[model samples]
Target: MASKQDTAAQGTPVSGGTASQHTTPPKPSADAEDAAKDKKPGTVSIDQDVEDKDHQLPPHPEPLPPQHPSFIHCMPPKNPAITKNKHSVFLAGSIEMGNAVQWQPHMVKRLHHLPITVCNPRRGHWNTSIIPAKDDMDFKTQVEWELKALDDVTVVCFFFDHNTRSPVTMLELGLLAEKHKVVVCCDKRFWKSGNIHIVCGKYGIPYCETFEGLVGLIMKELKKNDLDVDENGKLLSEPSSAD
Candidate 1:
């Protein structure tokens, strides 16, 4: 009964209206749908929460193997045969009784992986009360043992601890300086570092300021003598001859 224009103006459905006469709601965008999926209970997408497997970190590597111990020869009373084929190092340094640091054990540990012998003069059971005189047989024997070991070893390694005077070490340095087989390491704080440095420079001996540097210099000397090895104690391969 209502006119068509009046029915449309009053917001009422027109009589026998076609489907095309009404508006259709828009479809959700792809991004909105994805966001809705991620918001679902117990559901998480890679972009929203989970990290991609391709970008994940790698597993840790295995640790290196343990090193082998070197042959060590301590000073007199307990005579052990020296390894003839292996190179030897004589630890001649600050042994100011209770005053000096026990550096020999550390040095021996550093060179443990190498095929070498270490001549350690610091006795495990030294008679500290013995008078250091020619008349004292014990003193004479100890001094004689050091002298022979210093003379026989492949290299003489010296470390001047800053805490002690080490006059005997200085004397030993002077004795071996001209031999070109000596390597010296002196703490910068040592009282006589200047004198040691000058002597090393004059004799063309390798001088370093730290214990580790002394070890490196010793390795270099060994390498020069055909005992080739890397810093990690791995033996270096010999270069093949050209046909």
Candidate 2:
């Protein structure tokens, strides 16, 4: 028979394994522990659902492949007087508040006095963003609006300065040129002013370099249109001395 001391020296067995050799296996790494917690036996994780909770998405939803926007044609309001006068003018320019304020009010007031009807885009006027037009309103819409405003008006009046060469203005120019309207471009600065000069020259449209000169050109056209009528339409030909 073995003595008790001899048995202790060989180590003790509990059930199937040695008691001293057994451990709680060693606590797993944080990642391993989390992974083990996430996984279930014989089942796969839904990866899409997991990713959705952790990710941010775009504001506008992802569009479908081969998408096409529906195209709609729109026209501007018409006035009977524009047809009878046979001279309609469209005024377009930059919305720079300080300097632009000079010509804009003057031009609008002058058009009100004339027999011709004016189609001035009432955007960014006294207040900005009065109407929130979409960025996608195309040149076709602008031109069609002006054209619809005219009954028989054949002429367009506008000035080109640095402010006038914006994308919208360029689009307006293209539309007017296509219709063979005489363009009157003015330049506020020498360098910025010449773009319209070339465009007008290329398209057989008239151009001026100064606001005063443009005013003269407009008067000349109006006089030519009236033929026998008085040059001043119920207003003094020259600016009032009191003003």
Best TM-score goes to which candidate?
A: 1
Query: Per-residue CA lDDT of candidate 2, range 168-241, in tens?
Result: 55556666764554546454343444566566667666555444334444555555555223433233332211
Candidate 1 root-mean-square deviation in Å: 34.6
lDDT of each: 0.59, 0.39
Q: Which regions of candidate 2 deviate over 4 angstroms?
A: 1-81, 84-86, 96-102, 123-144, 150-152, 161-165, 188-192, 226-243
Minimal lDDT window, size 10, model 2: 2-11
Shift of residue 32 alpha carbon in model 1, Å: 78
